[model samples]
Target: MKKLFLLGILSLFLCVLVGNVALGEEEKISIAYIGASTDLPFWITLRNEARNQANELGVEFIDLTPPSMDAQAQKNSFDNAIQMGVSGIIVGAADSRAFDDSLDKASEVGIPVVAVDTGIDHPHIASLVQTDNLSSAKIAGQYILDHMTRPGKVLIIGGVLGHQTGDARKNGVTEVLEAAGVEVIFRAADWLPEKAYEVAQNELAANPDLTAVFAAWDPGAMSAKSVVAERGLTGKIIIVGFDGDPANLKAIKEGEILATIKQDNVKMGRDSISLLVDIINGKEVPKYIPIDGFIIDQSNVDEFLQ
Candidate 1:
Protein backbone atom coordinates (compact mmCIF):
# COMPACT_ATOMS: atom_id res chain seq x y z
CA MET A 1 0.00 0.00 0.00
CA LYS A 2 2.83 2.45 0.87
CA LYS A 3 4.65 1.72 -2.43
CA LEU A 4 1.47 2.31 -4.46
CA PHE A 5 0.82 5.62 -2.68
CA LEU A 6 4.41 6.81 -3.37
CA LEU A 7 4.05 5.87 -7.09
CA GLY A 8 0.83 7.87 -7.38
CA ILE A 9 2.47 10.95 -5.76
CA LEU A 10 5.48 10.73 -8.12
CA SER A 11 3.18 10.46 -11.18
CA LEU A 12 1.22 13.54 -10.13
CA PHE A 13 4.45 15.58 -9.78
CA LEU A 14 5.67 14.43 -13.20
CA CYS A 15 2.33 15.34 -14.81
CA VAL A 16 2.45 18.82 -13.30
CA LEU A 17 6.01 19.35 -14.61
CA VAL A 18 5.04 18.20 -18.10
CA GLY A 19 1.97 20.43 -18.12
CA ASN A 20 4.08 23.46 -17.19
CA VAL A 21 6.56 22.71 -19.96
CA ALA A 22 3.76 22.46 -22.51
CA LEU A 23 2.21 25.68 -21.34
CA GLY A 24 5.55 27.44 -21.65
CA GLU A 25 5.94 26.20 -25.18
CA GLU A 26 2.44 27.32 -26.11
CA GLU A 27 3.04 30.83 -24.84
CA LYS A 28 2.24 33.35 -27.57
CA ILE A 29 3.09 37.05 -27.85
CA SER A 30 0.10 39.15 -28.86
CA ILE A 31 0.59 42.21 -31.13
CA ALA A 32 -1.89 44.82 -32.29
CA TYR A 33 -1.60 46.52 -35.71
CA ILE A 34 -3.35 49.85 -36.25
CA GLY A 35 -3.45 50.63 -39.94
CA ALA A 36 -5.33 52.75 -42.45
CA SER A 37 -8.70 51.61 -43.77
CA THR A 38 -8.63 48.00 -44.90
CA ASP A 39 -10.74 48.87 -47.95
CA LEU A 40 -7.64 50.03 -49.83
CA PRO A 41 -6.03 47.03 -51.55
CA PHE A 42 -2.57 48.10 -50.39
CA TRP A 43 -3.61 48.04 -46.76
CA ILE A 44 -5.43 44.75 -47.24
CA THR A 45 -2.26 43.20 -48.57
CA LEU A 46 -0.27 44.65 -45.70
CA ARG A 47 -2.70 43.18 -43.15
CA ASN A 48 -2.57 39.76 -44.73
CA GLU A 49 1.21 39.78 -44.89
CA ALA A 50 1.42 40.70 -41.25
CA ARG A 51 -0.98 37.88 -40.38
CA ASN A 52 1.07 35.36 -42.33
CA GLN A 53 4.24 36.45 -40.57
CA ALA A 54 2.54 36.24 -37.18
CA ASN A 55 1.39 32.71 -37.93
CA GLU A 56 4.92 31.67 -38.86
CA LEU A 57 6.32 33.11 -35.64
CA GLY A 58 3.55 31.62 -33.49
CA VAL A 59 2.45 35.09 -32.43
CA GLU A 60 -1.01 36.60 -32.15
CA PHE A 61 -1.76 39.64 -34.36
CA ILE A 62 -4.83 41.89 -34.12
CA ASP A 63 -5.65 44.34 -36.91
CA LEU A 64 -7.39 47.59 -36.05
CA THR A 65 -8.28 50.35 -38.47
CA PRO A 66 -10.97 53.00 -38.67
CA PRO A 67 -13.78 52.78 -41.23
CA SER A 68 -12.45 56.03 -42.57
CA MET A 69 -9.19 57.87 -42.00
CA ASP A 70 -10.43 59.35 -38.72
CA ALA A 71 -7.82 60.35 -36.20
CA GLN A 72 -10.15 59.90 -33.23
CA ALA A 73 -11.22 56.49 -34.48
CA GLN A 74 -7.60 55.37 -34.71
CA LYS A 75 -6.94 56.66 -31.21
CA ASN A 76 -9.94 54.75 -29.90
CA SER A 77 -8.64 51.58 -31.48
CA PHE A 78 -5.26 52.09 -29.85
CA ASP A 79 -6.87 52.66 -26.46
CA ASN A 80 -8.94 49.52 -26.81
CA ALA A 81 -5.92 47.48 -27.79
CA ILE A 82 -3.99 48.77 -24.81
CA GLN A 83 -6.83 47.73 -22.52
CA MET A 84 -6.80 44.26 -24.05
CA GLY A 85 -3.30 43.77 -22.55
CA VAL A 86 -1.35 43.15 -25.70
CA SER A 87 2.39 42.58 -25.46
CA GLY A 88 3.18 45.03 -28.30
CA ILE A 89 1.60 47.22 -31.01
CA ILE A 90 2.38 48.15 -34.62
CA VAL A 91 0.72 51.31 -35.91
CA GLY A 92 0.55 53.36 -39.06
CA ALA A 93 -0.57 56.43 -37.22
CA ALA A 94 -3.52 58.20 -38.84
CA ASP A 95 -2.28 61.47 -37.43
CA SER A 96 1.22 61.93 -36.08
CA ARG A 97 0.11 63.89 -33.03
CA ALA A 98 -3.36 62.49 -32.45
CA PHE A 99 -2.13 59.21 -30.96
CA ASP A 100 0.37 60.73 -28.57
CA ASP A 101 -1.72 60.16 -25.46
CA SER A 102 -2.75 56.68 -26.44
CA LEU A 103 0.87 55.78 -27.12
CA ASP A 104 1.82 57.23 -23.79
CA LYS A 105 -0.81 55.08 -22.12
CA ALA A 106 0.52 52.00 -23.84
CA SER A 107 4.01 52.78 -22.67
CA GLU A 108 2.75 53.26 -19.12
CA VAL A 109 1.22 49.80 -19.29
CA GLY A 110 4.64 48.35 -20.15
CA ILE A 111 3.70 47.48 -23.74
CA PRO A 112 6.22 48.14 -26.49
CA VAL A 113 4.98 50.04 -29.55
CA VAL A 114 6.45 50.06 -33.05
CA ALA A 115 5.41 52.40 -35.82
CA VAL A 116 4.93 51.08 -39.35
CA ASP A 117 4.21 53.04 -42.58
CA THR A 118 3.63 56.18 -40.52
CA GLY A 119 5.48 57.30 -37.41
CA ILE A 120 4.66 59.03 -34.18
CA ASP A 121 6.67 62.08 -33.09
CA HIS A 122 6.92 60.74 -29.56
CA PRO A 123 9.99 59.12 -28.10
CA HIS A 124 8.15 56.26 -26.40
CA ILE A 125 8.03 54.18 -29.58
CA ALA A 126 10.31 51.17 -29.60
CA SER A 127 11.20 51.36 -33.29
CA LEU A 128 9.97 52.70 -36.62
CA VAL A 129 9.74 50.36 -39.62
CA GLN A 130 8.79 52.23 -42.77
CA THR A 131 9.86 52.99 -46.32
CA ASP A 132 12.00 56.02 -47.03
CA ASN A 133 8.97 57.98 -48.13
CA LEU A 134 10.71 61.26 -48.94
CA SER A 135 13.43 59.64 -51.05
CA SER A 136 10.98 57.35 -52.82
CA ALA A 137 8.69 60.28 -53.56
CA LYS A 138 11.62 62.20 -54.95
CA ILE A 139 12.31 59.35 -57.33
CA ALA A 140 8.72 59.47 -58.62
CA GLY A 141 8.81 63.26 -58.78
CA GLN A 142 12.00 63.23 -60.85
CA TYR A 143 10.34 60.79 -63.22
CA ILE A 144 7.50 63.25 -63.75
CA LEU A 145 9.92 66.11 -64.29
CA ASP A 146 11.83 64.15 -66.89
CA HIS A 147 8.76 62.79 -68.69
CA MET A 148 6.49 65.82 -68.85
CA THR A 149 7.18 68.11 -71.79
CA ARG A 150 5.57 71.38 -70.79
CA PRO A 151 6.03 73.65 -67.75
CA GLY A 152 2.27 73.77 -67.17
CA LYS A 153 0.45 73.24 -63.86
CA VAL A 154 0.61 69.96 -61.89
CA LEU A 155 -1.61 68.57 -59.15
CA ILE A 156 -0.18 67.00 -55.97
CA ILE A 157 -2.58 64.55 -54.37
CA GLY A 158 -1.59 63.86 -50.82
CA GLY A 159 -2.66 61.17 -48.39
CA VAL A 160 -4.38 61.86 -45.06
CA LEU A 161 -2.94 65.20 -44.06
CA GLY A 162 -0.50 65.05 -41.13
CA HIS A 163 0.02 61.33 -41.46
CA GLN A 164 3.80 61.05 -41.31
CA THR A 165 4.37 58.93 -44.41
CA GLY A 166 1.93 60.89 -46.57
CA ASP A 167 3.29 64.18 -45.34
CA ALA A 168 6.84 63.14 -46.13
CA ARG A 169 5.88 62.05 -49.62
CA LYS A 170 4.05 65.26 -50.35
CA ASN A 171 6.94 67.31 -49.11
CA GLY A 172 9.39 65.35 -51.20
CA VAL A 173 7.40 65.84 -54.39
CA THR A 174 6.81 69.46 -53.65
CA GLU A 175 10.50 70.06 -52.99
CA VAL A 176 11.54 68.46 -56.23
CA LEU A 177 8.93 70.26 -58.33
CA GLU A 178 9.52 73.62 -56.72
CA ALA A 179 13.23 73.31 -57.37
CA ALA A 180 12.62 72.34 -61.00
CA GLY A 181 10.57 75.55 -61.60
CA VAL A 182 7.22 73.74 -61.96
CA GLU A 183 3.90 75.05 -60.68
CA VAL A 184 2.55 72.66 -58.00
CA ILE A 185 -1.07 72.81 -56.85
CA PHE A 186 -1.76 70.88 -53.67
CA ARG A 187 -4.84 68.82 -52.71
CA ALA A 188 -5.70 66.46 -49.88
CA ALA A 189 -7.93 63.35 -50.38
CA ASP A 190 -7.68 61.45 -47.12
CA TRP A 191 -6.11 58.47 -48.93
CA LEU A 192 -9.38 57.29 -50.49
CA PRO A 193 -9.52 56.38 -54.17
CA GLU A 194 -12.99 57.81 -54.59
CA LYS A 195 -11.94 61.00 -52.88
CA ALA A 196 -8.88 61.19 -55.08
CA TYR A 197 -11.07 60.71 -58.14
CA GLU A 198 -13.43 63.44 -57.05
CA VAL A 199 -10.56 65.83 -56.37
CA ALA A 200 -8.85 64.98 -59.64
CA GLN A 201 -12.05 65.40 -61.59
CA ASN A 202 -12.60 68.82 -60.03
CA GLU A 203 -8.99 69.84 -60.65
CA LEU A 204 -9.18 68.72 -64.28
CA ALA A 205 -12.40 70.60 -64.79
CA ALA A 206 -10.95 73.74 -63.24
CA ASN A 207 -7.56 73.50 -64.92
CA PRO A 208 -7.59 71.80 -68.31
CA ASP A 209 -3.93 72.73 -68.83
CA LEU A 210 -2.84 70.55 -65.89
CA THR A 211 0.17 68.71 -67.34
CA ALA A 212 0.94 66.28 -64.51
CA VAL A 213 -0.51 64.71 -61.33
CA PHE A 214 1.42 63.12 -58.46
CA ALA A 215 -0.28 60.85 -55.94
CA ALA A 216 1.19 59.61 -52.69
CA TRP A 217 -0.36 56.14 -53.06
CA ASP A 218 -1.23 53.81 -55.90
CA PRO A 219 -5.01 53.89 -55.36
CA GLY A 220 -5.07 57.68 -55.39
CA ALA A 221 -2.82 57.85 -58.43
CA MET A 222 -4.88 55.20 -60.21
CA SER A 223 -8.02 57.19 -59.45
CA ALA A 224 -6.43 60.29 -60.89
CA LYS A 225 -5.30 58.33 -63.95
CA SER A 226 -8.86 57.11 -64.59
CA VAL A 227 -10.17 60.64 -64.32
CA VAL A 228 -7.45 61.90 -66.64
CA ALA A 229 -8.35 59.23 -69.18
CA GLU A 230 -12.05 60.03 -68.90
CA ARG A 231 -11.24 63.64 -69.70
CA GLY A 232 -9.29 62.48 -72.81
CA LEU A 233 -5.97 63.56 -71.32
CA THR A 234 -4.43 60.10 -71.14
CA GLY A 235 -1.21 60.69 -73.04
CA LYS A 236 -1.23 64.44 -72.52
CA ILE A 237 -0.93 64.47 -68.75
CA ILE A 238 1.66 62.37 -66.90
CA ILE A 239 0.49 60.53 -63.74
CA VAL A 240 2.89 59.33 -61.06
CA GLY A 241 1.90 57.46 -57.93
CA PHE A 242 3.58 55.61 -55.06
CA ASP A 243 3.15 51.99 -53.91
CA GLY A 244 3.77 49.30 -56.50
CA ASP A 245 0.38 47.62 -56.42
CA PRO A 246 -0.18 44.97 -59.08
CA ALA A 247 -2.81 47.16 -60.74
CA ASN A 248 -0.36 50.04 -60.85
CA LEU A 249 2.16 47.77 -62.55
CA LYS A 250 -0.46 46.97 -65.18
CA ALA A 251 -1.25 50.65 -65.56
CA ILE A 252 2.43 51.39 -66.18
CA LYS A 253 2.44 48.66 -68.82
CA GLU A 254 -0.62 50.22 -70.44
CA GLY A 255 1.14 53.62 -70.39
CA GLU A 256 -1.45 55.22 -68.08
CA ILE A 257 0.72 55.77 -64.98
CA LEU A 258 4.26 57.03 -65.39
CA ALA A 259 5.74 55.14 -62.41
CA THR A 260 5.23 53.94 -58.84
CA ILE A 261 7.55 53.27 -55.92
CA LYS A 262 7.31 49.68 -54.71
CA GLN A 263 7.58 49.13 -50.99
CA ASP A 264 8.44 45.73 -49.58
CA ASN A 265 5.32 45.73 -47.44
CA VAL A 266 5.47 42.06 -46.49
CA LYS A 267 9.05 42.41 -45.45
CA MET A 268 8.14 45.49 -43.47
CA GLY A 269 5.45 43.58 -41.57
CA ARG A 270 7.64 40.59 -40.91
CA ASP A 271 10.59 42.68 -39.78
CA SER A 272 8.48 44.81 -37.47
CA ILE A 273 7.03 41.75 -35.73
CA SER A 274 10.43 40.13 -35.50
CA LEU A 275 11.86 43.26 -33.91
CA LEU A 276 9.04 43.40 -31.40
CA VAL A 277 9.65 39.76 -30.44
CA ASP A 278 13.35 40.47 -29.94
CA ILE A 279 12.63 43.52 -27.84
CA ILE A 280 10.24 41.49 -25.68
CA ASN A 281 12.96 38.90 -25.23
CA GLY A 282 15.37 41.63 -24.02
CA LYS A 283 17.30 41.68 -27.31
CA GLU A 284 18.76 44.77 -28.92
CA VAL A 285 16.72 46.49 -31.61
CA PRO A 286 17.53 49.40 -33.89
CA LYS A 287 15.81 52.68 -33.13
CA TYR A 288 15.00 53.12 -36.79
CA ILE A 289 14.66 50.49 -39.51
CA PRO A 290 14.20 52.22 -42.85
CA ILE A 291 13.10 49.70 -45.46
CA ASP A 292 14.24 50.46 -48.99
CA GLY A 293 11.82 50.86 -51.91
CA PHE A 294 12.10 50.57 -55.69
CA ILE A 295 10.79 52.60 -58.61
CA ILE A 296 8.78 50.74 -61.27
CA ASP A 297 8.33 52.62 -64.49
CA GLN A 298 7.75 51.74 -68.15
CA SER A 299 11.45 50.95 -68.40
CA ASN A 300 11.26 48.30 -65.63
CA VAL A 301 7.57 47.38 -65.33
CA ASP A 302 8.09 44.20 -67.34
CA GLU A 303 10.45 42.76 -64.77
CA PHE A 304 8.03 43.46 -61.90
CA LEU A 305 4.85 42.51 -63.78
CA GLN A 306 5.56 38.82 -63.66
Candidate 2:
Protein backbone atom coordinates (compact mmCIF):
# COMPACT_ATOMS: atom_id res chain seq x y z
CA MET A 1 0.00 0.00 0.00
CA LYS A 2 2.87 2.44 0.80
CA LYS A 3 4.43 1.66 -2.58
CA LEU A 4 1.16 2.48 -4.35
CA PHE A 5 0.88 5.83 -2.50
CA LEU A 6 4.45 6.71 -3.38
CA LEU A 7 3.79 5.99 -7.08
CA GLY A 8 0.69 8.24 -7.12
CA ILE A 9 2.64 11.12 -5.51
CA LEU A 10 5.39 10.71 -8.06
CA SER A 11 2.81 10.97 -10.91
CA LEU A 12 1.31 14.12 -9.32
CA PHE A 13 4.74 15.79 -9.07
CA LEU A 14 5.50 14.86 -12.69
CA CYS A 15 2.16 16.39 -13.81
CA VAL A 16 2.90 19.61 -11.88
CA LEU A 17 6.38 19.81 -13.37
CA VAL A 18 4.97 19.41 -16.91
CA GLY A 19 2.34 22.08 -16.22
CA ASN A 20 5.03 24.58 -15.16
CA VAL A 21 6.93 23.96 -18.42
CA ALA A 22 3.81 24.64 -20.46
CA LEU A 23 3.13 27.82 -18.47
CA GLY A 24 6.68 29.01 -19.13
CA GLU A 25 6.16 28.54 -22.86
CA GLU A 26 2.93 30.52 -22.77
CA GLU A 27 4.59 33.83 -21.83
CA LYS A 28 7.20 34.83 -24.37
CA ILE A 29 7.83 38.24 -25.99
CA SER A 30 4.52 40.10 -26.42
CA ILE A 31 3.68 42.46 -29.34
CA ALA A 32 0.64 44.65 -29.79
CA TYR A 33 -1.03 45.76 -33.04
CA ILE A 34 -3.48 48.64 -32.66
CA GLY A 35 -5.02 49.47 -36.02
CA ALA A 36 -8.23 49.87 -37.97
CA SER A 37 -11.27 47.66 -37.48
CA THR A 38 -10.95 44.20 -39.08
CA ASP A 39 -14.54 43.73 -40.24
CA LEU A 40 -13.49 44.58 -43.82
CA PRO A 41 -11.29 42.28 -45.90
CA PHE A 42 -8.32 44.64 -46.31
CA TRP A 43 -7.92 45.47 -42.61
CA ILE A 44 -8.67 41.89 -41.64
CA THR A 45 -5.86 40.60 -43.85
CA LEU A 46 -3.45 43.19 -42.52
CA ARG A 47 -4.08 42.27 -38.86
CA ASN A 48 -4.05 38.54 -39.66
CA GLU A 49 -0.71 38.71 -41.42
CA ALA A 50 0.77 40.68 -38.54
CA ARG A 51 -0.53 38.08 -36.12
CA ASN A 52 0.97 35.33 -38.26
CA GLN A 53 4.31 37.07 -38.35
CA ALA A 54 4.22 37.52 -34.58
CA ASN A 55 3.57 33.82 -34.22
CA GLU A 56 6.45 33.07 -36.58
CA LEU A 57 8.72 35.12 -34.34
CA GLY A 58 7.31 33.41 -31.20
CA VAL A 59 5.73 36.54 -29.73
CA GLU A 60 2.29 37.34 -28.35
CA PHE A 61 0.12 39.62 -30.58
CA ILE A 62 -2.55 41.88 -29.14
CA ASP A 63 -4.97 43.04 -31.85
CA LEU A 64 -6.92 46.10 -30.80
CA THR A 65 -9.60 47.21 -33.23
CA PRO A 66 -12.11 50.00 -32.73
CA PRO A 67 -15.78 49.14 -32.93
CA SER A 68 -15.99 51.07 -36.18
CA MET A 69 -14.41 54.14 -37.80
CA ASP A 70 -14.81 56.31 -34.77
CA ALA A 71 -11.70 58.43 -34.32
CA GLN A 72 -12.35 58.79 -30.58
CA ALA A 73 -12.68 55.04 -30.19
CA GLN A 74 -9.40 54.50 -32.08
CA LYS A 75 -7.67 56.98 -29.81
CA ASN A 76 -9.12 55.23 -26.81
CA SER A 77 -7.58 52.00 -28.07
CA PHE A 78 -4.22 53.70 -28.37
CA ASP A 79 -4.57 55.00 -24.81
CA ASN A 80 -5.43 51.53 -23.62
CA ALA A 81 -2.36 50.05 -25.30
CA ILE A 82 -0.17 52.74 -23.84
CA GLN A 83 -1.61 52.13 -20.39
CA MET A 84 -0.95 48.40 -20.74
CA GLY A 85 2.72 49.24 -21.43
CA VAL A 86 2.97 47.09 -24.55
CA SER A 87 6.46 46.48 -25.88
CA GLY A 88 5.62 48.45 -29.05
CA ILE A 89 2.75 50.04 -30.95
CA ILE A 90 1.60 50.15 -34.59
CA VAL A 91 -0.63 52.98 -35.68
CA GLY A 92 -3.20 53.11 -38.51
CA ALA A 93 -4.93 56.10 -36.99
CA ALA A 94 -8.12 57.46 -38.49
CA ASP A 95 -6.76 60.93 -37.89
CA SER A 96 -3.04 60.80 -37.46
CA ARG A 97 -2.98 64.23 -35.92
CA ALA A 98 -5.57 63.38 -33.31
CA PHE A 99 -2.99 61.31 -31.45
CA ASP A 100 -0.54 64.18 -31.09
CA ASP A 101 -0.66 64.36 -27.32
CA SER A 102 -1.10 60.65 -26.79
CA LEU A 103 1.88 59.97 -29.05
CA ASP A 104 3.99 62.27 -26.95
CA LYS A 105 2.93 60.33 -23.89
CA ALA A 106 3.90 57.08 -25.64
CA SER A 107 7.24 58.61 -26.51
CA GLU A 108 7.76 59.62 -22.90
CA VAL A 109 7.27 55.98 -21.94
CA GLY A 110 9.74 54.84 -24.64
CA ILE A 111 7.21 52.82 -26.65
CA PRO A 112 8.29 52.84 -30.32
CA VAL A 113 5.60 53.54 -32.92
CA VAL A 114 5.35 52.34 -36.51
CA ALA A 115 2.82 53.80 -38.89
CA VAL A 116 1.21 51.66 -41.59
CA ASP A 117 -0.87 52.68 -44.64
CA THR A 118 -1.99 55.97 -43.07
CA GLY A 119 1.05 58.01 -42.11
CA ILE A 120 1.48 60.04 -38.95
CA ASP A 121 4.46 62.35 -38.79
CA HIS A 122 6.29 62.56 -35.45
CA PRO A 123 9.87 62.36 -34.26
CA HIS A 124 9.25 59.23 -32.18
CA ILE A 125 7.97 57.16 -35.11
CA ALA A 126 10.46 54.39 -35.85
CA SER A 127 9.17 53.59 -39.35
CA LEU A 128 6.31 53.97 -41.82
CA VAL A 129 5.34 50.89 -43.85
CA GLN A 130 2.85 51.58 -46.62
CA THR A 131 1.99 51.16 -50.29
CA ASP A 132 3.41 53.31 -53.07
CA ASN A 133 0.08 55.02 -53.62
CA LEU A 134 1.22 57.69 -56.07
CA SER A 135 3.03 55.37 -58.45
CA SER A 136 0.30 52.73 -58.33
CA ALA A 137 -2.32 55.34 -59.10
CA LYS A 138 -0.20 56.35 -62.06
CA ILE A 139 -0.32 52.73 -63.23
CA ALA A 140 -4.11 52.77 -63.09
CA GLY A 141 -4.09 56.00 -65.08
CA GLN A 142 -1.79 54.59 -67.73
CA TYR A 143 -4.05 51.55 -67.94
CA ILE A 144 -6.93 53.92 -68.65
CA LEU A 145 -4.85 55.52 -71.37
CA ASP A 146 -3.87 52.18 -72.84
CA HIS A 147 -7.48 50.91 -73.03
CA MET A 148 -9.22 54.25 -73.39
CA THR A 149 -11.53 54.68 -76.37
CA ARG A 150 -10.67 57.68 -78.52
CA PRO A 151 -12.03 61.00 -77.30
CA GLY A 152 -12.89 59.40 -74.00
CA LYS A 153 -14.82 61.00 -71.15
CA VAL A 154 -13.45 59.60 -67.86
CA LEU A 155 -14.85 60.05 -64.36
CA ILE A 156 -12.51 60.13 -61.36
CA ILE A 157 -14.04 59.41 -57.94
CA GLY A 158 -11.30 60.65 -55.64
CA GLY A 159 -10.68 60.77 -51.88
CA VAL A 160 -10.74 63.85 -49.69
CA LEU A 161 -9.00 66.65 -51.57
CA GLY A 162 -6.23 67.42 -49.07
CA HIS A 163 -5.51 63.95 -47.69
CA GLN A 164 -2.07 62.65 -48.63
CA THR A 165 -2.97 59.13 -49.79
CA GLY A 166 -6.00 60.39 -51.69
CA ASP A 167 -4.09 63.24 -53.27
CA ALA A 168 -1.22 61.01 -54.35
CA ARG A 169 -3.56 58.54 -56.04
CA LYS A 170 -5.73 61.29 -57.52
CA ASN A 171 -2.70 63.11 -58.86
CA GLY A 172 -1.15 59.96 -60.31
CA VAL A 173 -4.19 59.13 -62.41
CA THR A 174 -4.99 62.74 -63.23
CA GLU A 175 -1.45 63.46 -64.40
CA VAL A 176 -1.59 60.56 -66.83
CA LEU A 177 -5.14 61.27 -68.10
CA GLU A 178 -4.80 65.06 -68.47
CA ALA A 179 -1.37 64.89 -70.12
CA ALA A 180 -2.86 62.59 -72.75
CA GLY A 181 -5.69 65.07 -73.50
CA VAL A 182 -8.34 62.75 -72.02
CA GLU A 183 -11.42 64.68 -70.89
CA VAL A 184 -11.72 63.95 -67.15
CA ILE A 185 -14.23 65.00 -64.48
CA PHE A 186 -13.01 64.85 -60.86
CA ARG A 187 -15.37 64.30 -57.91
CA ALA A 188 -14.04 64.37 -54.35
CA ALA A 189 -16.11 62.03 -52.19
CA ASP A 190 -14.03 62.47 -48.99
CA TRP A 191 -13.54 58.68 -48.84
CA LEU A 192 -17.11 57.95 -47.82
CA PRO A 193 -18.92 55.02 -49.49
CA GLU A 194 -22.34 56.68 -49.53
CA LYS A 195 -20.72 59.81 -50.88
CA ALA A 196 -18.99 57.77 -53.58
CA TYR A 197 -22.28 56.11 -54.49
CA GLU A 198 -23.98 59.48 -54.76
CA VAL A 199 -21.20 60.94 -56.89
CA ALA A 200 -21.18 57.91 -59.17
CA GLN A 201 -24.90 57.96 -59.90
CA ASN A 202 -24.92 61.71 -60.44
CA GLU A 203 -21.98 61.58 -62.85
CA LEU A 204 -23.47 58.64 -64.78
CA ALA A 205 -26.73 60.51 -65.10
CA ALA A 206 -25.00 63.60 -66.45
CA ASN A 207 -22.58 61.74 -68.69
CA PRO A 208 -24.01 58.49 -69.95
CA ASP A 209 -21.17 58.11 -72.46
CA LEU A 210 -18.27 57.89 -70.00
CA THR A 211 -15.34 55.99 -71.49
CA ALA A 212 -13.84 54.79 -68.19
CA VAL A 213 -13.81 55.36 -64.40
CA PHE A 214 -10.96 55.41 -61.85
CA ALA A 215 -11.60 55.14 -58.12
CA ALA A 216 -9.04 55.76 -55.37
CA TRP A 217 -10.13 52.69 -53.36
CA ASP A 218 -11.84 49.35 -53.95
CA PRO A 219 -15.14 50.29 -52.36
CA GLY A 220 -15.31 53.21 -54.73
CA ALA A 221 -14.73 50.75 -57.54
CA MET A 222 -17.58 48.60 -56.20
CA SER A 223 -19.72 51.71 -55.99
CA ALA A 224 -18.98 52.50 -59.62
CA LYS A 225 -19.67 48.86 -60.53
CA SER A 226 -23.06 48.95 -58.81
CA VAL A 227 -23.96 52.27 -60.43
CA VAL A 228 -22.95 50.95 -63.83
CA ALA A 229 -25.01 47.80 -63.20
CA GLU A 230 -28.03 49.91 -62.28
CA ARG A 231 -27.92 51.45 -65.75
CA GLY A 232 -27.32 47.97 -67.31
CA LEU A 233 -23.88 49.14 -68.45
CA THR A 234 -21.45 46.86 -66.57
CA GLY A 235 -19.11 45.87 -69.39
CA LYS A 236 -19.65 49.16 -71.19
CA ILE A 237 -17.52 51.11 -68.67
CA ILE A 238 -13.90 50.17 -68.03
CA ILE A 239 -13.48 50.37 -64.24
CA VAL A 240 -10.19 50.52 -62.32
CA GLY A 241 -9.68 50.67 -58.56
CA PHE A 242 -7.06 50.70 -55.78
CA ASP A 243 -6.78 48.38 -52.71
CA GLY A 244 -7.04 44.85 -54.18
CA ASP A 245 -9.89 43.96 -51.85
CA PRO A 246 -11.58 40.54 -52.09
CA ALA A 247 -14.96 41.69 -53.39
CA ASN A 248 -13.21 43.67 -56.11
CA LEU A 249 -11.27 40.53 -57.06
CA LYS A 250 -14.53 38.61 -57.48
CA ALA A 251 -15.91 41.50 -59.47
CA ILE A 252 -12.87 41.49 -61.76
CA LYS A 253 -13.22 37.73 -62.24
CA GLU A 254 -16.82 38.31 -63.34
CA GLY A 255 -15.67 40.94 -65.87
CA GLU A 256 -17.10 43.95 -64.06
CA ILE A 257 -13.95 45.82 -62.96
CA LEU A 258 -11.19 45.99 -65.53
CA ALA A 259 -8.33 46.19 -63.03
CA THR A 260 -7.15 47.42 -59.59
CA ILE A 261 -3.84 48.22 -57.89
CA LYS A 262 -3.05 45.40 -55.44
CA GLN A 263 -1.01 46.66 -52.50
CA ASP A 264 1.50 44.23 -50.97
CA ASN A 265 -0.37 44.15 -47.69
CA VAL A 266 1.24 40.88 -46.68
CA LYS A 267 4.63 42.55 -46.86
CA MET A 268 3.32 45.57 -45.00
CA GLY A 269 1.97 43.35 -42.23
CA ARG A 270 5.04 41.14 -41.93
CA ASP A 271 7.34 44.12 -42.14
CA SER A 272 5.39 45.98 -39.47
CA ILE A 273 6.00 43.19 -37.00
CA SER A 274 9.61 42.86 -38.12
CA LEU A 275 10.27 46.54 -37.55
CA LEU A 276 8.79 46.51 -34.05
CA VAL A 277 10.67 43.34 -33.16
CA ASP A 278 13.89 44.98 -34.31
CA ILE A 279 13.16 48.05 -32.22
CA ILE A 280 12.44 45.88 -29.18
CA ASN A 281 15.82 44.22 -29.67
CA GLY A 282 17.67 47.56 -30.01
CA LYS A 283 18.17 47.10 -33.74
CA GLU A 284 18.00 49.77 -36.41
CA VAL A 285 14.96 50.03 -38.74
CA PRO A 286 14.44 51.95 -41.96
CA LYS A 287 12.60 55.26 -41.75
CA TYR A 288 10.40 54.77 -44.80
CA ILE A 289 9.36 51.38 -46.17
CA PRO A 290 7.48 51.37 -49.46
CA ILE A 291 5.66 48.26 -50.73
CA ASP A 292 4.79 48.21 -54.42
CA GLY A 293 1.32 47.64 -55.85
CA PHE A 294 0.34 45.56 -58.89
CA ILE A 295 -2.57 45.40 -61.28
CA ILE A 296 -5.24 42.72 -60.73
CA ASP A 297 -7.30 41.92 -63.79
CA GLN A 298 -9.12 38.95 -65.30
CA SER A 299 -5.87 37.66 -66.75
CA ASN A 300 -4.37 37.11 -63.28
CA VAL A 301 -7.39 37.38 -61.01
CA ASP A 302 -7.45 33.60 -60.64
CA GLU A 303 -3.96 33.78 -59.14
CA PHE A 304 -5.23 35.87 -56.21
CA LEU A 305 -8.50 34.11 -55.44
CA GLN A 306 -8.69 33.06 -51.76
For residues 1-306, write the lDDT of model 2, one tens digit per residue.
Answer: 999999999999999999998776555556668776666567778888999999998888988877455567878888898999888888776566668788899999998889888777788888999998888888999998998655668999987666567778989998999998888899998666688889999999999778899998888889999999999988888999998999999999999999999988888889999998898778988999988888989999999998
Candidates' C-alpha lDDT: 0.86, 0.85
> What are the RMSD figures for all models against the true structure?
2.7, 5.9
TM-score of predicted structure 1: 0.90
Candidate 1 residue spans exceeding 4 A from truth:
1-26
Evaluate candidate 2 by giving its C-alpha RMSD to the native, one decimal.
5.9
lDDT score, residue 130, model 2?
91
Clashing pairs in 2: none
Leading candidate by TM-score: 1
